[model samples]
Every structure is written in structure tokens, then in C-alpha cells.
Target: MDQFRSFDQLRTNELSVLRHGFFKLWFELTDGQFCYGKLSYGNFWKTIYILEVEKKTWIIKRKGIFKRSFLINDLDGMNLGVVTPEIWSRKIRLSMNNGFEAVYLNKKLISRTFTLTNDQFGDILNIRTELWGFKKPFKISFDLDMLKKIPELPLLALLGVNLVLIKQAKAANAAS
Candidate 1:
């Protein structure tokens, strides 16, 4: 699959993360669709398990507790590959099984990137991958006019962003 076209929908007018309770988060599309995830502890240490809103499918399994590393899978539970953070370079690199490398550029102001699937590209969230003042919640923006669609790519992209932010928070906490 072409890297560029695979994640063309990652950016749009409507994507937001809503907190239902502590550790219970839902990816809310302005069109009333929802994708949900829960933060858990176990063999994976800190694992993020995501469910697509439409089919209630577990599309993402992020298994890195002490670091921002993940092996993202597809619908059939096959490994798509991993996303590792290059903090020194301010980028998240997605390494796919087919030897496709896509970069998610992380900057203080704006960060943008894409994820890949087997046949086609998928969801994109228009978000800034940075945390603000202490104790402030993270924020994401979605194109409200885009309408509702499948939740696979959005969930993938969201999981990737969460991993990056969580790693940054951990580092900061460790430093202090």
C-alpha cells in the first residue's frame, strides 16, 4: 500500500477524546459515533486496549508500560508493526511488516503523521501531541463535518499519540 494515501483521512474537522471516568476514555466523533479504550495493568504493565465503536472490535493492543513502544495489529489480529518514539528526533516511527516506514512528526506547536493498513489508508485525528500546564487535560480536535466512519484508523492514530504523550509524561515525572 502507498504510505501517503494510507492515512489521508487522519486529519479532519472532528476528533476528540472524552473521559468517562478515571482510566476510561472514549474517542468521540462529532457525528455521535464513539470508540472507547481502557487503561489497564497486567503482563503488559501499562496496556491500552481499544474497541472500535461501530463493530466493538478490539483493534489496538499497546503493550509497553515503561516506554512508548507498541505493536499495532489489524482486524484479523495480525501484527501491522510497531511504533517507537525517537524522542531525540521528536518523531514517532512506524515500522510495518512490509518494510514501510512512516514518521509522525512531533513538535511543540504541531505534530502530524499517518498509520498504515494492508489494503487502504484510514482515520486521522487533527491533534497537537503535547501536554499543556500542570494538571491540565489533553486536547484533540476533529472535523465535525466529516461524518461518521469506521473507527480502526482513528483508534490506531489515537493510540499512537497516547503512547507518545504518556512517555513524555513519564520522563518528566522521572526527572523531577
Candidate 2:
């Protein structure tokens, strides 16, 4: 896959994260037609998920046995960033080695909508889950201007989706 220099190069501000398989939960990020990225579980326990965007691959895995944080690493095994969730709130913080930081949190306690915001860029992206779909795909809306400022916008967006999936899985397990 060829690398996209930025999200603006994709020529669209909207995308979707769709699940392909039944049991495996393979996911692909698309703009309704073309796939921009894909994600798959690295193990049966779902502790690790492999993320592929353009020509690059990343690994997102649980940080520790007793922690809720996740660590992101590149294909070369270099640590790229970390995703840490606030204990008493739904907000999650993404901190990268380059000093870029952002927050991903729900728009409302009972809503399926989520937003990603940066201190400098405000709200850069929004993700809403369809209420009627079996796949429950995430509809992503991006701020192109912010994309220009943050080169890692796509990676951050996908990571936010991954976090949401992790939370949903935990909730399902707890319910059953």
C-alpha cells in the first residue's frame, strides 16, 4: 500500500470503520467505497490488535496485566505512543513521542457519538455508531484543517475506534 501524505490527500473528510468477519471481528476503515486501513486481533484474547494504515503497520496492545492503558508500537518495534483512559471518566488521552496529544471521549453518557480533540485544534474528529446496523459501523467526520496540523490524524482516529471496541467488548463480557 502506498502511504498517504495526509488525510486531505484522500479527497474526503468522512470515513467509516466496518467490521468484515463474524467471529474474528476484522475491521476496515473506509469512505464507503475504498479502504484506507484495516485492523485485526493479534491473539484470541484480544489483548493485542494489529493496525495497518497505508504502507505502515502498528501494534496496539495492553500495557500491563492490571492496567487499562494501551501501548502503540510501529513495525520496527519502536514505541510510538500510549492510550490511557481516565479512571472516573470516559475520556482517553493519546500521547505520542513527538509531543502530540489528544483526547477521545463520548459526547454524552448515553450517546454513541465520540469526539477527538486536541488542545490546539479543538475537536478534530467525530465518530458516531449507527443505531440499526448489525455491524454497527462507525461514521467518522474529520476536520481537514486540523489534519494539516496533525499528520497522525488517521492513526489517532483509528486508535479511538479501537478504544471504543475494547470498551464495548469489556461491557459485553461483564454483562454475560
Candidate 3:
């Protein structure tokens, strides 16, 4: 539905609803690859996955394996669920809450500029350390192409830790 707005468009519209979620969409045309990282509204992070369409499969680099397949070939093997093909633009919103969001795309989820209004500039600043152990906390971002190796695929490890930090804040706030 055209009425379904792009995440970027939604940001421009400036709808306020406490917080919202975004679809995970990242593509590096230079490398001919596509990836997805979802963070639900105020929820924790979800593992990102890359599609190996040439092979007709999606794969995730196993943790502790370091760039190795954590699952066997045909990761889903039919049970993994259907792989739906749709075309549309994609935009992601990263809020101060720090969580994984998964939104369905009406289109291909390719390129769309989305904006996120964060209520906490200082909270993000404050949680920087607890989120990223390094002395400097990485900025809250929905970036997809900041890679460490081979065309700088998304900055995953760092992003993951940041999710942890965000979740902690949510948990603490709930307790309070």
C-alpha cells in the first residue's frame, strides 16, 4: 500500500508514539550482497542474517566460529520458513532505547533514508560505556555498511554489544 510510508518518510512526518520499530535492510551493491538486522521496539537485538541467493539460502556467521557457518547447508531446509520476495525501499530508525526491530517492507527494502528522534541525547551519552566496553561508546546508529572486513559489511560485534547496553537500560527502567 502506498499509504504505507517509508521509515524515512515516517520520520519526516514526525509521528510520536513513545517509540517505534524498523526493518533490517542493508545492501552493498559493490559486493552484490544483502543483509538484515532487526531490533524490535524497545526489545533486545536479533541476530543479523545474510542472504546467499545465488545458492538460494540465508546464512549467519556462527558465534565463536569466527566467519564460519554455525549451521549446516540449507540452514532452513524448508523448515526455516518461506522466503518471500517483495520490492520496496527501506529505512531504519535507531532510538535511544536500543533494541532490535523487525518491520515488513512493502517493497524491496533497498534504499530509503529514515530518521529517528531520540529523547535522550544524554542517556545515549551516559550509556555509551556500559553498551560498548571501549572507553568510547559507539554512536547509536542503524548503519548497515560499516564493516570490519571485506567491504566493511555492517559493524556487527560492536552493534551487538550496544544492543546489550540498550537492553540493560530498559530492564533497569522497568524495575524502577
Tell me the whole-model lDDT of each prediction, alpha carbons only: 0.47, 0.82, 0.27
**In terms of TM-score, how similar is model 2 to the real structure?**
0.91
Candidate 2 — what's its lDDT?
0.82
Best by TM-score: 2
Model 3 alpha-carbon drift over 4 Å, by segment = 1-37, 41-162, 165-175
Superposed Cα deviation of residue 97, candidate 2 (Å): 1.0
Q: Which 10-residue span in candidate 1 carries the lowest summed lDDT?
A: 1-10
- Positional deviation of residue 18's Cα in model 2 after best superposition, in angstroms: 1.6
Candidate 2 at 71: error in angstroms?
0.5
Q: Runs in model 1 with CA error above 4 Å?
A: 1-12, 23-44, 56-68, 97-101, 109-125, 129-152
Question: What lDDT tens digits, residue by residue, belong to model 1 across residues 1-176?
Answer: 12112223334443444434345333332212433333222224345554343333344445555766777666688876787877667666767676655555543444333322222333234454335422223445544332344324445445554554565667799999
Q: In what order do the candidates fall by lDDT, top score first?
A: 2, 1, 3
| lDDT of each residue in 33-135, candidate 3, tens digit only | 2212221222123344443322233343333434321221235543332212123433222311123222222123332212222232211111112233233
Question: What lDDT tens digits, residue by residue, belong to model 2 across residues 11-115?
Answer: 788887788887777888887667788778999888888988776788998899998888999988899999899989889988899998888988677988889
